[model samples]
Target: MKRIIGTGLCLLVLFGYPMTVQSQTLPVVQRFVLNVDYSRFWQNDSTMYIEISTAVYPNLILLQQDSLGFHGKVELNISIQNKSTGAMVYANRYNVPIHLADSASLVRTGSIVNNTIYALGSGEYHVSVIGSDVLDRTRKDSSSFTVTVQNKPDSLALSDIELCSNIIESSDQKDVFYKNTYRVIPNPSCVFGSTSFPLVYSYMEFYNLNTNLMYKITAQIVDAKGNVKKQRAHLRRFSLPNVVDVTTLNCISISSGRYTYEVILSDTLGQVKARSRRPIYLHNPNVKAASAETIVTARAEFEGMTSDELAEEFRKAKYIAQSDDNNTFEKLSTAQAQKEFLEKFWTRIETEENGKSNLSRSSYLGRVSISNQRYKSMSRAGWRTDQGRIYILYGEPDEIQRFPNSGDSKPYEIWYYHQLEGGVQFIYVDLTGFNEYTLVHSTKRGEVQDATWQQLLR
Candidate 1:
């Protein structure tokens, strides 16, 4: 195995930004984009096992270009604090090396996932992880979560479920991935779908099982609204007192969104014993859209929304909102005022059928969900992107003309709307080549229009 670089750095090649100094001296500070997650298991009566998993984007980090292509690195600083005594229990750092053959390979490689495990005494503790771009110290992200690890060897209980990218049979005990005769790869970002990770593999530990007793394990995929989307069950009679189990689900047929990967344990008599649940996000673009049930029930559930949540919803709704409606919301700093404002705004904006208003709030929101699932990019949410804005403001395009990279040309797409303005089309160009296409031209009214759009491809 090759050693990876974490905090150590070579000669600095930092990217510069324009400042009052007027020279390219100051580096632009950006968020070190990544996701950190973990799972807890009983190692013994007095100790607990903690595995920290991180998924980070290689394309998002700053790198130096050379004959070897793009080279960069990221580091994760992990710390465990004992909450009872307000003391630090454990600390360590890990490295992730990134190598890209060229710019185009960035989108295809997706994110790099890494894992590290630690053992700590059974107690309540706070775990913190800080991710940083090794070349740019100012670019970093930090997150923390509390865990209560308890002794479970004498009880019939299951450990915290570990979401994974892969699990394969392995005999290489010396390998860092080797665990319980299998190589388990964790997906810290918890993103799965067709364009992203398609298989959802869950690894968990079962303890204090009776060899003669029959047990049942139920695995389910639940949507954000607590609706079960897919489920299956298995039965087994254990031959060992403690064992590890791996279960997998194919999310290709499921819609993209935030959901829960949950496991339930029960006995032959259907008595529930243990359950573990973790949130996961799926990004299955074009496989399936979000369900209507999840969108339709969202309105009645918006009673206690925070001010930020209310304002964001209004921002999405602003695609169809008039200037006056936006101005009205800008003054609504209070939750109650924003909620009341949105109700009246929707009443005036929702589509009408047979001289009566229908539930367009849910309908519009469904479009937003679909856009977010299909068109999201590395820099911004799909709902905020140019293509997503168009999809929400208008319906789907009648035809989409796609063009991949050709000689002297960047990848671009032309979306045509047959009904809008009699005949209209929107052109998006991948100026960055990371799939963050920008709208350059459009024939539709009130849209960005560039008559010489062909120059952009050149």
Candidate 2:
């Protein structure tokens, strides 16, 4: 009897029918798909617009293939929420049907699609999308995005925009003042470079959100210590074409460091206007590496000198070192010889415990170091030749007049310094060889007679 029942059940299964099967229902799955082509929208007056599309898919079958089925509606809700305060400033909802042909490729496109929205005020906002399938099973989906709301011209007002580094105590509670929008480029903390620094500002339209006109713009530069170093109020008439264009306010020669800049925009009456504040940090290049050469040369020169003699030499040389060699001096085979030479060179110049070196002795050794680093030519260091002697004594001139490729006149550079007593100028000419700069003339105080160019030869 049991064999007969099992055989009967097997025959039923082979015929696509089960005799003792339990009925069970599976959960339906729904998917909501949404996408936005443009992520950013500009605020125009009280209205803002965005473009979006959404799609929905159901995992379960609701009706037979040839039968008409009740389709559910899709709901999309978009809201603009403030990013800073988490406040919902604007919200909107739209409902549409999910009706499609049984053989309509299972894809449905939304009909009532709008890409624009209007809002009031200027601030940061977010957009959210929500969807739901109104079938027997309660299935829903949601997603969100962000947008920025900017102030229009009509919503802006010019008031006493006083900008100060610190708050001031006053009798009136309404005396609180904030800074106007102003930015300094290549911030004070920045090192000098080929690029120029700029200061930028913008104006807001008062009570009008659509107005793009910005009013009176002025910029001021303060030093790292918060002291007003430079002020340019004439820029008040300047207007920016766009918010991003305001970065053109950068200035030149703004040293690197922490700096605070204030921008004031006002009307014709000089009344204070819209204000914004920004802090800037400019970075200076690592100059510590640059001075390494100076330090190394000083150490090498003072290898054998006493502390007192070293101090006197530094004072007379106006600098500590005689060579611009960044590497430490190495006297592998002739260490004693090199040490003895260095000591004799300083001992001959030491007049007293800490007195100045004798005039006959070479005191401007630091100048030699600078010239060797700056004016080397033809595989020869500047300090190894005659031209080096002049440079070491007088330093680089205020002006250098070059005679390039002039076969007859010869090439030369004129060094000028007005601070020297009686105004000194050195005329360097390439006398011995090509591309060589040699001091041929030295003029003092416009009197070419008392000059001492030949003294370098001796």
Candidate 3:
């Protein structure tokens, strides 16, 4: 989620997707790079409008205090080549003055956001943007992607869906993002969920409308497998031939997944017209498990699921379950019984302050997915590994000291948790050379505390 600084909280320049590359320097800086994308709208038969937006990590550049404020300069080269003729159709080299929105980017979520518009003909073009910190050419990034300019239709038409963090109705004409009596702040990263935007907004233009006939606007959130997770529609009639439509979806309750925000235009008779779609990734970890009454209403839905499936969902959540929960769940023989128990299980957890555990089903599973990537061993699943257990149990460690193997000892790592139980350390040593580290010592109470654990490292 890339956003602007100072002016607002954070902002994105939602344009189009661009893949980034580096110039062989320490690629660690790659995390703090730039995002460049473009959205195409039909302008005329001979040309189309390519609206390009760039969100840059200011930390990647060197800034100096100037009259305007703390700012840096960046060199950029953008080119669009005709794929059919192997010739460059457009190319430009310029310097963009990068301004610091608020403070240092390291201390906040901020980016240098800017937008540009170009007019190109209807065809397939290969677009590329190469940029560098002007004072430090060695720190550079490049991106290239394909852009397809579609021809305009004579009937009702739709433009590319522009996802936004906000849509403000403003009368200021000089605003950088002002459009159609509104300001559309683009979220080019195509991301939404917890800790950021709980609602995703869309801005689009509809062309060649039938002013005399009534119309319908249908909006849907579709999954990867083409299943519609959510749908909404509204009836509208326009006095003008074309109009801009903006819609929003409450993404708070939608589960974490990859989805498509689609908008469809239909006539009063339910005849299909125009449609537009944009990809979105949502991570809604803060959504609480269903409430007591909500669970009661949904019990029948859960009972429709197989008893085995319901048990598996319970099993995956066993890390936080009580001893009695396991006993009761294991004895459930029918789907109805399992569904009732599952409802109670979630409802009870919604209020429990068990061990200060603050977890939603989405967040817990999210950590499990992350652990699988960080601690997977060859012999077993990552969650079954010793390190995975500590990670899932205690969250992220404050510090880690990794010791490589030498003649005197095997590779080992000591994880530090400063705030838990008055500061504790867990030590894992790779007795085997296969990177399978085993937990051998801990300073925490009720755990292995072998003073001679170093001897085993040998």
Candidate 4:
């Protein structure tokens, strides 16, 4: 059987900042972006496992020519100390590598995910991770986190809730986070869109289920206003020591907003056993007026495309097009006129960057692709989403901080751009329980920067 685990999905990306090094011999101050997720797994009655996965950015290190290829690597040294006694419990080291075949690969800023497992009893341990860029030993970063492990209780209980992007039957068990004869793909962001994902899949394990006793399970989709939109309840008996509850909820008709999907477990006596809630964002299409840029009657190569495809591109241009541009496109009588409008549309966003016109167009289209990949929610394409609009206008963010199901706040994310129109940040919140994070506020001029963003988190 395949199993999945979770604490909460935390994504931390580093920005350029200097921090002091612990060692006196190393005078260099370095910045590191690290993201990690830990989940407790029961291996047996006497043993438990803590799975730790770490993602690190390669731009934070220096690359050097090696026999295999040009590579940048980091040595990860971890130490676990007993929190109660302050005694060392375990220590280990692993090397993480990043490789590039050409010097032009310097622009790559992707992350490398590495995993390690540790066995411990039911107690608290302080885990200290020190990462050193192998090519430049002076550049190092350190962070510490605490983990508590415990043996599965003999009584009825539920495992930590895991929100997944995909849960499917596995014939060979190829995925790491597999359990109960299935492969579970976790959505660390916990954001879902209708076009890309129409259903929300959740998984949890019920431990110590009695074969003779009946259990009641309730799953609810609740909005931010404390209203339940959809619900499912089931009563069943289990004969196994561990029974996995996998629920798939249809989100097709759900409106866009911030909401929560909660699972409640109860016994036949009406006593609550275990309950878990996860935040979700739903995205619905929003209507907007077209731009009004002066119409350029000259035809362009885009005229060769089908009308549907041309209309889609114009719809995407809604972000950058002016009101007049919108009016002009709407007024266009021929496909040739629409193509010319697109030519001027791209030209309007073009700049004298490193590659000029082609570069600007390429860059804009690239943002479109990324927006679709990262922010597209149910029912709407990524380019039509709010985040997609901002990304196309402002390019990549310098820093991204995501808070998923944290505290009293709804699932939200903050995007910071150090040099955009004088240092601005965009805040997005999933006000509805679907996975679409609409822009709640922004620091950029002329954009909606709500002063009451704190209240929206609830």
Candidate 5:
């Protein structure tokens, strides 16, 4: 049996799942990411429709090979309970396999999106979801949410707006939330950060609309103080009995912080009849990771460092830093702002790992030190080198296969990881005969992959 890492109540799971108020003491699991969202059914006034969407990060799932290419299995469980009566109202359990074009994409930063639809009467209920990797049973994630179902008779109403990290058109393979040829990937946390997710996609349904009447749909990103920071408006004629509206908003330029994405429906008289809101968090990738004291300290630890030294350290964090982050850091006018950015970066990662101790920081720095000592070349430092980067990002490989001066090919090496996303391999080659090995290919998603890599040996 494989060793399972249980995440009882990590903050990431808490943000995405919203399980009952009960909290757990287990550390956060960094292996996988989960997202959940819901859409309301409008066809029947007496019966309320609630469709829940769930997505599993591809990098975290374990995949297997089949005639179709590569795929990973995920076991899912979902349930809804009446909060007032503590009665179970809806429940379901199923399994899904995510497929990819090739092995290298398995480490990519996308997700396998799946949605489930449930119809129930008007009431308040708690929704719960659990997802486990079938091949790696020890790795599982779950979430719980509170929802209400209410459908009034023949009235002009709008359902809750579904927020998504991604939305695309699908040609085949029907699933729930497939409307007008588009599939929406839910962003349960409603948080967009780093560079991986820079767009916010929204979808909603409007019912009992007078097709002849003109209405305005407005979306705004507001701060906690009730001030609108960003807004967009759309004027439409509800020609159909029911209207499904979808919109895409650019969030890459949004500042890092807390905010809410709200949608409001208004008539010609400028009266707000129906409105829905979802909380959102924007992360600033430019923030660097560093050690510092709170305000109590007169001068910060990073305050004394020179600009060149600070830039060098931040550069070493390339494995985790985003392109936008580097661009932002380069434009900073003052050292204080740079220090503050790094502080936030470190704090965010620390929060993700559970603030129980400084073990995460120590471990990462230790790996960096090892990379420098073992993989550094004539031009680059250890962490900056290809071999150093792989070690720092994934830790030590389970096995290393070295092929020096074999046949007419250049010297090469293969690193195997037995416990990462099922299993993966990384190949490095010394193309220049200078002992500096470059990462030629990898079997992990998001990493470089070349099926004809053997040809490069010459």
Candidate 6:
């Protein structure tokens, strides 16, 4: 007898049992067998891929006039093994049904499957396939194959990975884009206990559909002002098999502030593929407290100075102000306005007050008077000069180097500080050949380049 076993249906049949004496009996035989095939196997430096195919075969079976629709089920199992060691590397199982229509004259192709492995060292790999016939209810048919992983050339330079944080994708969308998922790590050596600096790091990855590996990548860090903080680049002649973990990027010491990190990927010819941005916040409570202390100490140092010293410092501040503005202080229209402005300015810089003991307020006013006496030019007081403003805001610098006019060398002065964060330096040049000095450049921690004073000259 025969039975049609369609999808979602199960069938069971039994032939006649052996007869008693004088009766004839037919032998029982299995009706179905299973088979599996692995058509292809290949490997890169660190991974291997396998393509699989499966089928089933019919065995001898007793059949009657109605035995025209016999059908059976088959189960398939695939696995990868290390030929050197007898251990199984990977395995998968699948179920398939064989219909009567699939006779020896007509075999059907099975579904194709692909698998991936990561971080595998170069070596020989083995793959095995096994099949079981549900009709015979036995694990009878099986097959096996082998694959080899060869070492890739060292010419493939694996670049460092960058993670970009807090990158807003578009002007309209104030949120970070899905495409931007780079991460940055700060420098551990520069990190002070409980002190945070404005810093960021970034990384990214790309894939070449043809070679199935990454091609090129780039990463950078920038401040809120759109200045480049740091940058790195990488290029690959041939495609890599898959993603790799590169070294982390670091940012220099910065104050507590907001920052953006960016990662970019492209082809060898510089065709952009993917881009991402990340935002990060560094917070250090101790640094904030220290900055406040610095401001207080600066104010006190100015108040404690002797009158002669104060006068000299005030003269310097005035010289700076007058040198820039044609020796003119923007005049106050009324005495009351001047008085009020001075009061507000002094109050902003004052940290404490004890009635007559308020030295901060007293010393600041004294400096203003001295500036007026020493730097008064055609239209303004000495205190209004560029030099005057700097001296009044920050105390006298630790050192000053002066260079008098000589040939093409212009008259210039370099002021240095000893204990400031990243140290401080200012260079003033008398570009106009006048007696007045003009601020040319300011450097903080040997990194920041401030040309605000240069803008005045221009």
Best by TM-score: 1
Give the C-alpha lDDT of model 5. Answer: 0.67
Ranked candidates (lDDT, high to low): 1, 3, 5, 4, 6, 2
Model 1 deviation from the true structure expressed as Cα RMSD, one decimal place: 20.0
**If scored against the real structure, what TM-score would every candidate get?**
0.59, 0.24, 0.54, 0.44, 0.53, 0.24
Per-residue alpha-carbon lDDT of model 4 for 293-350, expressed as tens digits?
Answer: 3222334456467544666677776766655455344323234334544665665556
Candidate 3, pairs of clashing residues:
3-11, 4-11, 14-188, 16-37, 16-38
In candidate 1, what are the lDDT values of residues 1-458, reduced to their tens digit?
Answer: 12222111111112321123221222223334566778888877778778777766654587666655666888889888999999987777767888766555554565676777778787799988888989887777676778888776577878888987778899987767778999887776665667545788999998888889899999999974577888889999889989998999888787655567899989988998888897776655454445443221224656977766887788788677755454345422235445555664565456333221243777788889998998999988898899998887776888999999999999999999887778889999999989988999998777899999889898
What candidate 4 gets wrong by more than 4 Å, as runs, is 1-32, 57-75, 99-112, 129-143, 173-180, 186-201, 219-236, 248-261, 267-271, 277-458
lDDT of 1: 0.72
At residue 447, candidate 2 shows an lDDT of 35
* Cα lDDT tens digits for candidate 5, 1-458: 11111111101211121122232222223444455666676647677768777666554565555544555678888888988888887666887766655444443435556667777777788988888888777877666667878765577777778877667787654545456577666665455655445667888877888877788899888864587767889888876967787877776665555567899888877888678886666554464212242111223557678645666667777667655455345433234445655765555545554422343445767889999999999998888888998898888899999999877999999999988768899999998889999998999888999888888899
Q: 329 in model 4: Cα distance from truth in Å?
A: 40
Task: Note the residue pairs that clash in candidate 1.
Answer: none
- Residue ranges of candidate 6 with Cα displaced over 4 Å: 1-348, 352-359, 373-380, 444-458
Candidate 5 residue 327 Cα shift, in angstroms, is 30
Q: Over the stretch 3-22, how does candidate 2's per-residue lDDT look in tens digits? A: 00000000000001112223
The alpha-carbon lDDT assigned to residue 178 of candidate 6 equals 24
For model 4, the local distance difference test gives 0.64
Cα lDDT of all candidates, in order? 0.72, 0.39, 0.68, 0.64, 0.67, 0.42
Q: How close is candidate 2 to the true structure, as a TM-score?
A: 0.24
The residue-by-residue lDDT of candidate 3 on 197-257, one tens digit each, is 7788888888888888888999889864587777889999999977889998878776654
Error of 2 at 189 (Å): 45
Which portions of model 3 show Cα errors greater than 4 Å? 1-30, 59-70, 101-109, 288-458
